[model samples]
Target: MDSRVANDDVSYSSEAAISRWKFAVSRQYQHLLDKSTPHVLHRWIGCFAVACIYVLRVYTVQGFYIVSYGLGIYILNLLIGFLSPQVDPEIHDGPGLPTRGSDEFRPFVRRLPEFKFWYSITKAFCIAFVMTFFSAFDVPVFWPVLLFYWVVLFTLTMRRQISHMIKYRYVPFSFGKQRYNGKRASAESTSLPVD
Candidate 1:
């Protein structure tokens, strides 16, 4: 009879442990689901809603002004990139150079870079400021809507720029003759193995 009682207690404890484990696993799964589902859905829904709102608002004159302002800012940034000095201070002086035969690629950062980013951003704000004076953006839309649209547009445009940089092996910065020669020397050393 004592052995029978012990067996029942063992079975009951095992069942209780299994139940607790299952509850914990289920809670963990629910937490993951809650976190991930909203993040992915928010990106898609936010994008779609912004597109719909843009289309709906585009018939107004304010939409045109906003678009023109954004375009102007983008153009200014490109011009700055073109005119800025080619030497990258980060590449030239940041750290010790790699050994003569290393296979690593070091990228250059801009030195004395054109203040284009600041100028373009300031220009956009200036345009937006002027637009506010004309009462054009007050077209019965929430300010948050316009802000979200601009943020999305900026993110998408920046992504495209980054993709372009990745696709093209060229860096826009200028390297002096010495840097160029160093790079050539490195290339030659790597192409021919040490005897």
Candidate 2:
């Protein structure tokens, strides 16, 4: 009887340990997914919506206001980014991954951060609101025309951005570096061998 009781206790403890390990792993995966995939998707969606609204109406008073607000918020965000330290001291001390020396030398990408997505959405809505007031939707502007124009602009901008990113292997998010640096980089890399 004593042996049986000891064996049962050991089994129970082992089961509890396995359950705890599974829970920890699940939580970790969730954190990684939240940080990477969903964050990027949200940003792209917000930007796309805003672009759509902009192309639909060129001269919206509300669009102007929303754009102003977004610009203000974006400027404030950039200021905060400039003021904040590049590295998080607390993260360094915590059990997070060690920073690579290469990471320090990399340029900051101007990609919109997660927090700014809401502001972008608000900006889109404001632009849409202005269009509604102006009856821009009633205008003979085809939806495809707006979508195609936006796509072309977006593609051109993204291509330039990607080209710059590939050449420098860095994204410049600072005020001075925010604009697409690809044309300059491409002009410079003309001498390099293409794969």
Candidates in order, TM-scores: namely: 0.29, 0.32
Task: In angstroms, give how far residue 132 of model 2 lies from its true place.
Answer: 1.9
Q: Which 10 residues in a row give candidate 2 its minimum summed lDDT?
A: 60-69
lDDT of the structure predicted as candidate 2 = 0.54
lDDT of 2 at 34: 65
**Model 1 C-alpha lDDT per residue in residues 1-195, reported as the tens digit of each score:** 999999999999999999999999999986864564446445445445644454455445444545544544565456446533254333446543233445365554443333433334444444554555455554565545666776676677767655645543444555552355788888988897669
Query: Candidate 1 local accuracy as lDDT?
Result: 0.54
Total backbone clashes of candidate 1, pairs 3 or more residues apart or in separate chains: 1
In angstroms, how far off is 192's CA in candidate 2? 48
User: Which portions of model 1 show Cα errors greater than 4 Å?
Assistant: 1-124, 173-195
Residues 117-186 of candidate 2 have per-residue lDDT tens digits of 4554555456554645554344454445555655575567557545644543443345554355888988
Q: Which structure among the candidates has the greatest TM-score? A: 2
